[model samples]
Target chain A: MLKPEILDPQGQAVQRALPRLGFEGVSDVRQGKRFELEVDGPVDDAALARIHDLAESFLANTVIEDFTVKVEEMVGEEK
Target chain B: MLKPEILDPQGQAVQRALPRLGFEGVSDVRQGKRFELEVDGPVDDAALARIHDLAESFLANTVIEDFTVKVEEMVGEEK
Candidate 1:
C-alpha cells in the first residue's frame, strides 16, 4: 500500500474528478499495487521467508509503500 | 487486477530472477493495482454502485483488466 501522504494526491484527484463524471460521495481514493505469487511446491516456512525478503527488496518500494505477500496453493488446478 | 495473460510476463520475469538471488519455490507472480477509497458519509448502495461505475470507466482497463473497488470507513481518525 502507498504511504498515506504519497497516495493522497491521487486520491484527491480522483475525489475531485469523479463528481463531474456523476460519481459523488466519494472522498478518498488511494491506489497501490498487488502481487500474487504461485509457488512450485508446498509454501513452507523457508519459501515464505524468501518471499518476505523478495517483497521487501524487489516487489515493494519500502521507502514509500507497504505491501503484503500471500501464498495461494493451487489445489488440483492448472494455471 | 490484471488479466492473467497480461500479468504473466512480469510474473515470469520475477520468478526467473529471484531464484538467481537464492530464492526458490516461487513459480508465478502476478501483479496488479489496489485502490482504497474513503467516503464522506455512510457508504450505502448508491455510493457503492457509483464506485463500481467509476472503477469500470476510469480505474481499470475493462478491455484487458479486471478491478475491484472497496470503500473503507474512517472511524474517529483524521486524514
Candidate 2:
C-alpha cells in the first residue's frame, strides 16, 4: 500500500469531502494505490526483504508517497 | 483493499507487464484503491462494522470488485 503525504492536495481534498458523503464520523480520507503481488516462491524473510527493497526502489515514489509490503503465505500445496 | 476480478482487463494488463519491469518472480500484479479513514472516535468493533457497511455501500463498487477493510487504532491521546 502507498499513501500520499498528508499535505498532498489530493488527500486533503478527500478528507474535506468525506463528511459530505455521509461518513459523518470520518475525519480524514486519504486515497492511495494498492499493489497485490503473487510471487512464485516461498515468502520467506529474505524474500520479504527483497520485496521491500523493490518497493522502495521501483514500485513507489518516495518523494511524495509511502508504501508498505505485506507477504501472505500460500495456503495449499505448492505446485 | 479492493481488487478487480481476475477477468478484469486492467488487472490482466498489469500482470502481463510486471515481468517486463523486472518483477520476474511476480506472476500477478493486481492494482486497486487504498483508502485510509481517520474516524473521530475509538476504533471499536461497532465502528469497524459501520465502516465495513460504508465501504460496501459507498466506497467500493461491489458489482466488479472485492474489498477488504482493516481498522487500526490511533496511537496518540485523543483530543
Candidate 3:
C-alpha cells in the first residue's frame, strides 16, 4: 500500500466517486494491490526476509509504497 | 480478486518474471485489489452488509472478480 504521505490519485478518485453513487458513511478510502504467493516450500524467516527484499526491489516502489507479507493459508494441508 | 476461472494475466506475468529475477520456488501468484475504508460510525452487521453490497456493486467487477469485506482495525479503539 502507499505510504500515508504519498499521493494516491487512484484511491482519491474512488473516494470521491463513492458518495455520488449513493454509498454513504465512508469517510475515507485508500486502495492498494494485494498478491497471494504460493510457495513451493516452507516459508521460513529467511524466505520472508528475501520476500521482503523482493517486495522492496521489484514488487512495490519503496519511495511511495509500503508492503506487508503474510501467510494466508496452507492449501490442502489440513482443516 | 479475480475468480479462479478468470485469466489473471497480471498475476501470470509476475509469476513468469520471478524466476528470471532470481526469486525462485514460487509456484503460483494471484493478484487483487485491497481497499481500506474508514467509516464515520460504528461498524455493525448492517454496516458490513452495506459494505459488502458496495464491494459487489462498485468495488469489484462481479463478472470476473469476487470480493470479501472485513474490518481491519478500528482507530481510537482499545487493542
Candidate 4:
C-alpha cells in the first residue's frame, strides 16, 4: 500500500474551480493511489521486504512523491 | 503500486447513507491509501522491494483490507 503524492495539480485545480462548478462545502481534494494483493497466507518480514520493493520500484516515485503502505489480513479473519 | 481492496464496508455504509447526507450527484465513495517517498536521484528495483515491505508491515491490513503502491519523481523535475 504505497501512496505517492504528486502535486495533485489536477485535484487542486478541480478543487479551486469546484466553487464555480456549483460545489460548495468541499474543503480539500487530493488525489491518491490504492492497491490490493494476495499472499500465501500470512506475511512475514521477508514478504514485507518484497512488497516494499514493489512500492519503490513501481508504486511510488521517490524523487518528488512520497508513499506509505499498510497490511492486514482478510476481513472477518480478525477476532 | 500495490493497492489492497477491502470490503470497504465503511465506504459502503456511507454510500448507502449518502443520499440522506444531501450529497447528490455523487456516485461512489471508496477509501484508499497513498504514499510519497524519496530516493537517491532515481529509484532502482532494489529500493522498490524495500518499500513494499513497509507497506505490508504497517501501511495496510491484509485481513479485511488491501492496498497498492506507486512511485514517481517530484513534479517539474522531469525535463
Q: Find the candidate with the highest DockQ and give its number.
A: 3
Q: Can you give the TM-score per candidate against the true fold?
A: 0.79, 0.78, 0.89, 0.41
Going through the candidates in the order shown, the clash numbers are 1, 0, 0, 71
lDDT of 3 by residue, A1-79 (tens): 9888888888888889998999899888899998878888778988888888777788888888889898777547765
- CA deviation > 4 Å runs, candidate 1: A71-79, B70-79
- By lDDT, who's the top model here? 3
Q: Which residue pairs come into collision in candidate 2? A: none
Q: Write the per-residue lDDT of candidate 2 for residues A1-79, one digit (tens) a residue.
A: 3343346566567667666776678877777887777887778887788778767876678876788787666547466
lDDT comparing candidate 3 with the true structure: 0.87
**Could you give the CAPRI-style class of model 3?**
high
Which stretch of 10 consecutive residues in model 1 chain A shows the poorest summed lDDT? A70-79
The candidate, 1 or 2, that scores higher on DockQ is 2
lDDT of 3 by residue, B1-79 (tens): 8888998999899999999999998888889999988888889999999899999998999999878898878656675
lDDT of 1 by residue, B1-79 (tens): 6776564677678778888887777767777777877777767898788778888998888888977666554556665
Residue A63, candidate 3: C-alpha displacement in angstroms: 0.4
Q: Is the docking of candidate 4 incorrect, acceptable, medium or high quality?
A: incorrect
Q: Score the docking of each candidate (DockQ).
A: 0.74, 0.76, 0.84, 0.08
lDDT for residue B33 in candidate 2, whole number 0-100: 83
Indicate which candidate wins on TM-score: 3
For model 3, name the residue pairs that clash.
none
Per-residue CA lDDT of model 4 for A1-79, tens digit only, reads 2123445675466456645654444354555555444445447786677667655665456776655666866666655
